[model samples]
Target: MKAVVTLIFLGLISIALCAVSIGDYSDKNHPGKCNIDGRILPPGIHQSPTECERISCGDNGFAERASCGKKMIRNCIPGELVDKTKDYPQCCLRYFNCNGEIVKA
Candidate 1:
């Protein structure tokens, strides 16, 4: 009985550790993104030289701009899509860059 209890306790600890590790990784990967089961996390917030802004992640995995400066423009694209800098206007267009960093185009 004691051996069984010890085994169960160890198993529980292992599971707990794994859960914590996963949570840490997720938070680190997507700071302001929501946590939805089976959904991919959106890109991180855009950090400009003057200010920072984040994007909103929809349940359908679409991203939208959440904030912008007075003269800055915001744009949204699918997380899986490549950043089409040339296609966007010269105005600030927010999207996830190739390096996964939120950037302004």
Candidate 2:
């Protein structure tokens, strides 16, 4: 019984440790490469293969992703909102009518 309890506890601990990684690609895993959808990207900003996120792969072998910064409707006169139906950058890039002028943001 004690042996079984110890094995179960060890297994739980291992599972918990695996769960702690939030899927961030690091140098420890693939040095200087951002592996997105099985395609290796060098250290630089690149578009995600499966999402609208802009991935920035640092030289340190870490990846940081960004999409639309924030949706701002202030001073926008019926400006264009994000069209999720579109592709990568076009999906997030929006045009706004500010002060009666069309502004691309």
Candidate 3:
């Protein structure tokens, strides 16, 4: 299980780096506020539209991004996904229960 988890995490790194989205604020007219993708964002951290990312806002109106990267095709026989509903890093922590379906781990 440990090895599988490690492999999964390692695989995520390659996928994660490319998909990182830096926040772009179009509200240059108003400093300290951000208008991203037509959404008004105050100063704070926000979840990206994809829900796979964490965006942070500040005085500049731009949101910082926390990317979990992307998933690549794997050779493993993927079964029911071992998933948890949580935030950012936690959300990215996932694996496949190939041997059986894990109702709760």
lDDT tens digits, residues 1-105, model 2?
999999999877544432121245664567878776676778887766555566777776567665544456787765454565565456665778888888776
Clash number by candidate, in order: 0, 0, 2
Q: Which stretches of candidate 1 lie over 4 Å from their true place?
A: 1-51, 71-105
lDDT of each: 0.39, 0.63, 0.61
> Residue 17's C-alpha lDDT in candidate 2?
31
Please give each candidate's TM-score: 0.20, 0.41, 0.51
Candidate 2 residue 78 Cα shift, in angstroms, is 16
Candidate 3: the clashing residue pairs are 15-70, 16-69
Which ranges of candidate 2 are over 4 A from the true structure?
A: 1-24, 27-29, 69-88, 93-105
At residue 88, give the lDDT of candidate 2: 47
Clashing pairs in 1: none
Tens-place lDDT per residue, model 1, 23-83, is 2213435564544343445544332222232334543434543222333223433232233
**Top candidate, metric lDDT:** 2
